[model samples]
Target: MSGTELMEKPAAPAKLGRAIPPAFQGKQFPLLAVIVFLALFPPLIQSDAYDLGLLNNVLIYSLLTLGFYWCFALAGQFTFAVFGMYAVGAYVSVWAARHLGGFWSGLVAAVVVTAAIGALTKLAFARCSEIYFAIATMALGSLIVILFREWTSFTGGYEGVSDIAVPSIFGYQLISGQSKYYLGLGILAVLLLLTVLFFRSPVARDLAFARDKGPVAAVTGLKPVRLQLMGFAVGSGIQGAAGSLYAHGSGFFSVEAFNIDLSLLVLLMLLLGGMVSMYGAIIGAVILVYLPEFLRDASKYAEVIYALAILVIIVAFPRGIAGLRHTLGRLVRRA
Candidate 1:
């Protein structure tokens, strides 16, 4: 146990900046694989425009789930108002498209406005934590849904906004399902990259410390409130962007589409994926999105079947589908 012997390990290399664990970093390979598969999928497998369109929806929902994961897993907040932000982004984008000329402006406006709203929500609930914060955010989401229903002129009230412009840039409209699918996939891929980068950034470290260490983090100079607000902003902005893309791509925007149920669905997606990491978000989204379709022929039992599957996942794999492989490996080693 001499000094030289003890120092031979080299202090674990003093990791200077944030970085994702090697296990999590490996997710990038699968993500890239999925992208390549998607590129070839339409022509080789799907071959149907409707199927491609369905996948585009899945991509949008994946973005929504990923955004929620950023807030819940990274920032350690339980806010569920992302649905509100999503709706606001949808309405804002559509409105902007009608008045401001095109999709780019609408997207820009949606992100900015939704981010501002997220920050404001954080400010208002700065003192609340855990369940209280969850309730307040849920309430805020409820209010947003009501506003969409009541604001006839702006939101189209119960009828919802229709005839949403096709997503375009500089007057070039993406009218085909294949075109829209690629566009949405590209946006999702970019967001996924950004999320990965965020996970490896100093801000992520700060937020992780604030969420897991709380008082210790505060004493160490991390501003928990400010970091939480930033989480909200980032999460809301991502959701908003997803909403905008969904609306413009589908050529429709409805208030009913954004509700407490949608929030719960997002939450369930995260839970199924595992709240411990971002990869869980993707796993949960893909499974939940496709499972329902597979069970469609089950008719009245679809809901029950889906519920049972989720229950099984929750009971058998508490860490989520993302962590399922690791869990199985551990069990195998133990055996």
Candidate 2:
């Protein structure tokens, strides 16, 4: 055949592979399975109130670490103000619950107030470098804690607030550990879904571009400041919600609970779980929370062990547990 005719000839049909089942095609099945498992977990374990409370603690810390992940990993906004936001959320929710309407109104107020504070903080430090911004936030967090301590009328002062009402919905109070656990789990699930959606959206892309190439992004007409502010607001709002849940669940909280140590712990959780992976936050929180319990007998060595573990993780698995999982997955594929 002439070269032109050969060129015009149809190629042989590509080999057809077996069609993959719809259920296994995407993340939907896995996600649903996870949700179902978590929903049924307490019942499956036959956990007592204490165990349920520990699980609730895990969920709370997971939310806090997720907020850290949103601010630092996703938005590239280095911050140490999470505990401050947490404190503000708890106090605001409690105060609003007493004076305004009820638990629900307080929760809303906490989110809104924290979001505004986060946005304003970012706006105020719009021109600062990341390190400076982090320092400013840390300072602001300290200030907030101090404010809560001295402003007794607002936060019950140094004595702290012990009259936090039991969170209720439709006149049904979440007074039991099991009920509270479910509430926290539901909130975490919703936030996790939202986080996934945010990762897949244009806003995430724009934020990434702005974060990694600020000048270039600005040149291209992207407002990096605004995007960063939005990220901060969302992250802070999440922390606030977590704090509000914590206050109602615990029924009491002091300034001591929102100290720098708590902030560092949240950071450690994020780092240990894999800063870039959303699942890492939950993993990290679970491990850290439970590890301390196991080490309580040797309390003196706990801090040392934690330090060593962090060092080893940083040196050996820089990306944390989630990164290790990815590596294992790749190795399995290769094998």
Candidate 3:
């Protein structure tokens, strides 16, 4: 065929029904299953308040971890300021709810403030990359923690903020464990859906391209900095939302809740779950959250066991638990 004819000809059709689109490939089924399970879970465990509480917490932190995955893993920004953003969201929400007369206002304020700060943070560190960027963000996160501790008038200082308002809608309070569980699960499901949708969108495509192939992305007319900042801002805002939910659910929070330790823990969760997959964040959050409870009776050995498990998972499954299915499939096919 002539070159023009060959170029004009439609590309060969993908194998019928086998060419899964990027949006749904390897993602929809598992997430759908999890969503269904979570949606139906609260009713099933109505009597098990303790377990419901744990599930609620898992949902809260999962949102934070997923936000981490968005900025750090997907956008390729090496930032650890998510914890700081979380604190800001929680404090702002609490303060707003108390002073502004409602939860809706607090929620909006938290998301807007946190997102603006995230964008500013990205701008401040626009020149830094890799380790330097990570260090800068970490330092900022720690500074935020200190600020929270020192700003007694605002954050309640060392004593922390207590008796923060619980979630209420139309004068209806969600006081019961089951109610909170559903609320958290609902928020988490929505955020997770948004995260996944973002991953499948053109923006995420460009961000991923910029992250993995900066030179090519630039050559293709993509603006890496803009995309990175968008990721950072959106991710931080998501963390902020998670934090607001956490504060309302718990009715109290201190600077300690958003310290560097929490940052590290959440980061570890991202790593152990698999940075490449959004589902990894969920798996990591569940395991880390539940493992502590499961090993609580071990007392002194609990931490050691936890550390050992992390090491084992990191060593044995470098790509994280999310990648295990692919690994097993490969081995089976080879055999």
What RMSD, rounded to one decimal, does every model reach? 5.9, 8.7, 6.0
TM-score for each model: 0.87, 0.87, 0.88
lDDT of 1 at 282: 63
lDDT of 2 by residue, 1-335 (tens): 11011122334434485544221223633663575476657634856877887888999999888888778876789899998999999999998998887898888998899989989998998889999999999999999999889898777776789988888878999888888888888888888877766654457667877877889999999998888789888888889998999999998788888988888989889888887567778889988988878788889999898778778887777778767855666778999
Question: Which residue pairs collide in model 3, if any?
Answer: none
Q: Candidate 3 residues 29-107, lDDT tens each?
A: 4655666576666557556878887778778878888888878876678777878899998999898888887677787
Cα-lDDT of candidate 1? 0.76
Considering every candidate listed, which one attains the maximal TM-score?
Answer: 3
The CA lDDT at 146 in model 2 is 92
Better of 1 and 3 by TM-score: 3
State which candidate, 2 or 3, has the greater TM-score. 3
Instruction: Give the C-alpha miss distance for residue 145 in model 3, angstroms.
Output: 1.8
Deviation (Å) of 91 in candidate 3: 0.6
Model 1 C-alpha lDDT per residue in residues 172-198, reported as the tens digit of each score: 789887778778777777777676666
Per-model lDDT: 0.76, 0.80, 0.78
Q: How close is candidate 1 to the true structure, as a TM-score?
A: 0.87
By lDDT, who's the top model here?
A: 2
